[model samples]
Target: MAPPRAEWLASSFACLLLYGFWGFLGKLALVRGLSSSQEAGLEKLGFFLTLPLILKPSATDPNAGPGLMERPKFALLAAYMSGVTAAAADFFYTRAMMKGDGGAVSAITASYPPVTMVLCATFMREKVTRNKLMGSFFTLLGAFFMARS
Candidate 1:
């Protein structure tokens, strides 16, 4: 791995902290009788909050990046994919937790870097080097070992 910049390091830690809380608090909520449907409904607030930032007029902010405004077609498709997958995954995850699934089991099952590597190789013409394959293998292997315990 390359040396981390301060900004990147800070953001990474922030994400880790938030994600840690997300899993912990999400499971806790399930334990406390929060329904999966309610969890799914609450998650939509995040998407709603992002609408202004996403749909803001480029004229309003001259320094805006080439986001959805630049490509409406693909943006719509991507947004659809993101929304559907996130909603479905959140529903199933919360449902699983409600049924007594452990956080470690969820982490192991949701780890998809290896699947991503294979997909990129097949669909995106990306290189699949020996090291990359080995790395992915070891990652899943480690997760498997952790899960088996």
Candidate 2:
């Protein structure tokens, strides 16, 4: 079942705040001379630590659906690849932040939503509305200006 509107909004707000803190803390660590690899490794450790707090045993929890290995092969492949890609992206982002202005690097990376939109449209046959096109144009333009700094 889908979340209620309020619940969804609250979760979205929480994500926004957490992600904002994630970037700020990452930049702070990078500035303090943490190597990108170290930052990525430690960050991944923190990520793993969160899993036990949330994951419940399927045997005890009726809602705890199928185990990971029981999922479709394509889904598992996609999830695994996404983890790899996200880690690589985090590493590269931290490397960039080590030398570049955090704001500039973040702005450039923030432009990824446009790339995601385009990819979805191309690969998933998602509709491309005019509003999305205009938003993408403005988003890219803003990123370009920020990156020039």
Off by over 4 Å in 2: 1-9, 56-64
- Candidate 1, residues 82-149, lDDT tens digits: the string is 87877777777777766755656566655767988998899889999898889888888877775764
Which regions of candidate 1 deviate over 4 angstroms? 1-13, 50-72
- Tell me each candidate's TM-score: 0.70, 0.83
The global Cα lDDT (0 to 1) of model 1 is 0.74
Positional deviation of residue 55's Cα in model 1 after best superposition, in angstroms: 9.0
* Model 2 C-alpha lDDT per residue in residues 125-149, reported as the tens digit of each score: 9999888999999989998898895
lDDT scores of the candidates, listed in order: 0.74, 0.85
Clashes of each: 0, 0
Clash number for model 1?
A: 0
Estimate the Cα RMSD of every predicted model relative to the unseen true structure.
Answer: 4.1, 3.9
